[model samples]
Target: MTLVARIRALPADLDDLAGAAAAEGFGMLGVLAREWVAGTQRFAMPEEALFAARDGAGVLLGIGGVTRDPWAPALRMRRFYVRPPARGRGIGRALVAAALDHARGAGAAMVRLRAPAAAARFWEGCGFRPIDDPTATHGLEWPGRG
Candidate 1:
């Protein structure tokens, strides 16, 4: 109820959310933690960001991030995860929307993501069209792009 998405300044602060994700068989959160700790990635680019969704009580419901694609020109959405109990409540969508807004503010024209097959419908529902690229499974182009 009334989830708010906010940019996270440090990955270490996401330990609880990351642990929950790992328990649910998602490894991206762990990767986020390790990469951040190792200085390999921190979602610190001018056009990149990490967002966490929290309820009124400050409980983390989900987390996600955007970054310049390592293999493409578009910004890439990554490390997205929502707790099982929080699924279907729009928490994930809110996180995605926040990440998109962040990208749009940075003048990005497109966003890409490599979603699992199970999440195809979810991504599509958010306006990301299925793609046949190896580095990305779905993409969303900004409206009015010529």
Candidate 2:
């Protein structure tokens, strides 16, 4: 299957986005569902961007975004989730590449994410390393630093 990732405008349906998050065990109907729910305005900036992945038929395969990391001076890759049937198809990698590319273009020195334990391998495979801070859920720093 051919997957295309792009930095398009966010979908108007919050429910759909929430459903995608819920599929990955992230709760849907809550303030903690996704950062965009709480900080919708943050994504308006060009530096803070959102990307969506769709199949040739236009099915939503996955969604991810990059925004200012609240805990540090870095861009945070947020709400990354892929549909069950679309796993292991390089969609996640494509999304991460888009986010990192955006970060680099925005003059960010690093990128970070607090990914779940289930996605540790994926993040590690993408060249993100765990940080030493215990307060972080599970942090990964951008490996390609200047």
Candidate 3:
């Protein structure tokens, strides 16, 4: 089935988004669960946005978000999770594209994400390069930035 993506606003979206993240082992440590709860609360702010991918039937297939970086003049991509059954179908790519578009519209100088090792290649494929840091997050400078 074809998947469509759009900005998400309902609290129910958070439940499904968090559940997808949890199913991907994010709940094992509980940090992501807490972040999902806290992050969604801030989504209405001018600096943040949440998105959901849904099938033609309107069943959610994936979710993600972007927010202004508190520590840098950049946008931070967060909570990107695609259901296992929906992986390999470009949902993640679509989500990242939407987030980057939002960042550019917000005048961000760059975009950053602390992706897990398992997702390193995926983020790289999305045009992010490893940042020189102990934690090894990925970053992408806004296009045309010298």
The runs of at least 3 residues in candidate 1 whose Cα sits more than 4 Å from the true structure, single-residue gaps closed, are 11-13
Residue-level lDDT tens digits of model 2 in 1-146: 65655555555554675676666678622332344456644466777887778878877787777878778877788777777778889999998888888888888877778777888889989888887655354444444654
Order of quality (TM-score): 1, 3, 2
Mind giving the per-residue lDDT tens digits that candidate 3 earns over 41-105?
44565757877788888778877778766667777887788878889999989999988887777
Q: Which candidate do you rate higher for TM-score, 2 or 3?
A: 3
Using lDDT, rank the candidates from best to worst: 1, 3, 2
Best of the candidates, TM-score: 1
How far residue 98's Cα lies from its native spot in candidate 1, in Å, is: 0.7
lDDT of each: 0.86, 0.71, 0.74
lDDT of 1 by residue, 33-60 (tens): 8898899988888888988887787787
TM-score of each: 0.91, 0.79, 0.81
